[model samples]
Target: MIFEGYHPLDKTMFQVMDEEGNIIKPEYMPDISKEQMMEMYQLMIQTREADLKALMYQRQGRMLTYAPNIGQEAAQVGSAFPLKKEDWMVPAFRELGAWLTRGAKLEMIYLYWYGNEFGSYMPEDLKILPVSVPIASHLNHAAGIAWASKLQGKDEVTITYFGDGATSQGDFHEAMNWAGVYQVPVVFLCQNNQFAISVPRGIQTSSETIAQKALAYGMPGILVDGNDIFAMYAAVKEAFDRARRGEGPTLIEAFTYRIGAHTTSDDPKRYRSDEEVEKWKKKDPIDRMKKYLMSQGILTEEENEKIIEKAGKIAEEAFKYVEASGDTVLEDIFKYHYKEMTPQLTEQLAEYKAYLMERGEA
Candidate 1:
């Protein structure tokens, strides 16, 4: 007999830590060691530094366009920590913290922003997919990969990242349907960072909470305080555990905000007011995490300085490495496609080489 208890559809937001970094639900906290907490803090610091450096690179015309992940560090880093090495991460473009936590090198990410295709080429052992720029396109791909893992009887789960805006895409629903029917091992992380390039979350959907939509797809959905790392980590770990137990998929709506412009080209002030930005800024993920660490005596002021310094050094080294590598060969792009080059590609390559040679630029 099913008891009609409290439904999560009642818009209950799960939060472990408050904006002031106080633990509000100690009983609900995950079993994260002090070492794990320190690591999470470091990842958040590194992410913020990387974002700032990328912005500078863009301003100086040293890099291509970038999508900043300034305020959502806790949401990305916390959720990424629980995955085993064999687990797959099919990521959207704005997942710098998550990628870094999953062992991706800063140099590779920098190369990606410099328009180097080699940047997105992750090592085979990492099990992370290349950044998907088209919104929600990889939704079904994550399901397909997880489904294959299930068929093979491998104990692996696939976790994918997307924005709240992606819920509008038909691919999202299709992926949900597949996961629901097959009971595949996959976790859907929707970072609801307020705006999807100027469109507010309220305008994105009529549902009171994005998590509630999971009911229609026959899955469990949890709305988490994205700025609270503790809550974020706990929710994601539980979801993955459920999937590994053959309980099917989960949808996590991380309630956070994007502190910066959507991309380098965007001007957020054109739509949202400065006051709203200031409000979210006060709840900055990194700051809250720092407060929690300090309160627990796990992080000292000296140690905090070192973490920030190390992160800055890493970003600096990445920028230097990418700049020193020089531009990729214009013709090299044609090589990775096919061993036996197509007739049209061969013709184009030959034409381009001839043109370059004529101009003494080959």
Candidate 2:
């Protein structure tokens, strides 16, 4: 496809569905069964509910710091579904749904937020890297992995998720340039939620759109309705397929809204108006999918209630597991640094342990 113009604003943004619960683009519809589509919608709803509950737990001091993925469930879950088992996924802080869809356990996610180092540890078989808090730094890691996979002749692609704010970072640009030059198998998924903390997307950059940045890298850049599950699934599947076919990288900008605080520590009311929040609520991804499902007679009120109840139960179980897991040990900080603790780390651990012992807190 020949893309005209240099900005996503001037190009055609692909979308399969509309906000009014209509599949406007029949040709772009996925080949998945109706049952599977309903299942995906159910899972996305469950994830959003779970994420909201986790935020409540953080506010009540029952859980650690939380990042709410309230409005981005479809973008996260749908994009994650097309990933292969062997492919690598590197996530930013706001990707709970993506991580869950990629096989991360709820308990581990809760534990990680509760300050447990082990929570960052993913099973080697899962091929998911640790959750990165340093914003765009993980883009470099993803690029490196893809470069190595290409060199090894492995049919693997790396997908990394970052926010619109992270797009302005030096590391993000560097990784894009390197990936483009090498033609590495990587997908740069940017969820442009219109804000980087209190800074709105308008103030973040004067660029026409985040997706347009990919033009400089010589890769296909797609803009899609992030709230529309069908659009997300189609865009990501196409990008993944191209990568597998050795066509190199693609950049996808999922246009959506945050609809919540940046984190439990943040208060959006300080910067954004309640009116804006209410406006986005009407365009909620879960509600859109629910409407579509109900129109198909695949989802009913009772089914929706049951799914919410089950998600609550699962979240409660995760909280219980995290609480029963106990606090992290002081020595654990030093243990995971290396296969074996170095002599300097050993001395520090011993000194810290001695101080705790003297205070009867070890």
Candidate 3:
């Protein structure tokens, strides 16, 4: 049985494996087959490789300033893989892998980093919100969507991804309060990478744990080893089940480390020590998952190499496709905001078009 009230806040935190790669609680394990687990392991590796390659592309000036999801691969991939197609996902800037798992195209993601607004284009029925860069603002949107689904008697759930720093925002508390009051079907997945930019977790909040903060909201708050795929998946799956069963919202604090800079624009080396980074590197999610797969005899050296090579090739092709797509058109910017442009905007567009014409640049 899944243990309850293990944490002081009475939140049920279940972790199957420890940092040393030992399975501590086999009974609470997910019902996934070994083959499936290996497949997920491969996917996680592919995601890591893709993330690294994308970062390199950004450094080479091929893409816009990008957020690296290097250390949070398990948190993103494991939690995202269990989500159904009907479930909606609202993500922060550092969720490219989760976005990809939710049916987002690599080409589209590349276009997004290449500075195209149309990169937000998803299929009409795909249940994904556009990337929210304004921190915790999307938490309210996720709660609202879940509340609407509850009102309409739809079983669809919504999951919102944010960082540890986002928890300090008023919007986060408001969203949690509303979700708790309305019993909305939402999961607040906070990937606590331990740092909000240069600020450490200790400086961000006075609370002992981010998960415990959910106690005041009258919802279940789970803390899991974010680097462990099994733990992340189990926590998220349980939360999703609770939401679907109309048990209101669940807050999940995935305790992982941010291995790289906050983004391509910021440098972590200035504030944090290399020793600290090295410590987290030992618990690398990709390496951990690969080790588990190897231990289970589900993956071989040749197969792993082939998987990485294939993902690299795909990443390269996506880069090529994005580079060939050219720059965004000036008119395209006027198309998204409103169905009909206001008089002021119309005048502005006309003036811009005239200026372009005068310069023979239209």
What tens digits encode model 3's per-residue C-alpha lDDT throughout 1-362? 23253452654556777767678888777888987787677677767877888899988988888888999988998889889878888888888768767778888887888899888778867788887899799999999999999999988889999999999899999999999999999999899999999999999998878988888988978788899889888878888888899989988888899998898999898989999999999999888877777777888889889989998898888888889984798877876667788787888889999999999998
Instruction: Quote each prediction's TM-score.
Output: 0.96, 0.96, 0.95
lDDT per residue (tens digit) for residues 1-362 in model 1: 00012144867788889999899988777898999899999999999999999999999999999999999999999999999999999999999999999999999999988988788889999999998999999999999999999999999999999999999999999999999999999999999998999999989999999888888888888888999999889888988999999989998899999999999999999989999999999999988988989999999999999999999999999999999994787866876467778999989999999998999988
Among all windows of ten consecutive residues in candidate 2, which has the lowest summed lDDT? Answer: 1-10
Most accurate candidate by lDDT? 1
Write the residue-wise lDDT of candidate 2 on 1-362 in tens digits: 32232247675677777888888988788888888887787678768878877888888898777888999999998899888898999888889878888888888888998889899888888899888998799999999999999999999999999999999899999999999999999999999999999999998988878888898998888788899988898888888988999999999999999988898889899999999989988888888988888898988999889988888899888889988984887879999889999999999999998999999988
The TM-score, computed over Cα atoms with residue i paired to residue i, of candidate 1 is 0.96
Model 2 earns a TM-score of: 0.96
Deviating ranges (above 4 Å) for candidate 2: 1-11
lDDT of each: 0.91, 0.87, 0.85
Q: Cα miss at 62, model 3 (Å)? A: 1.3
Backbone collision count in every prediction? 0, 0, 0
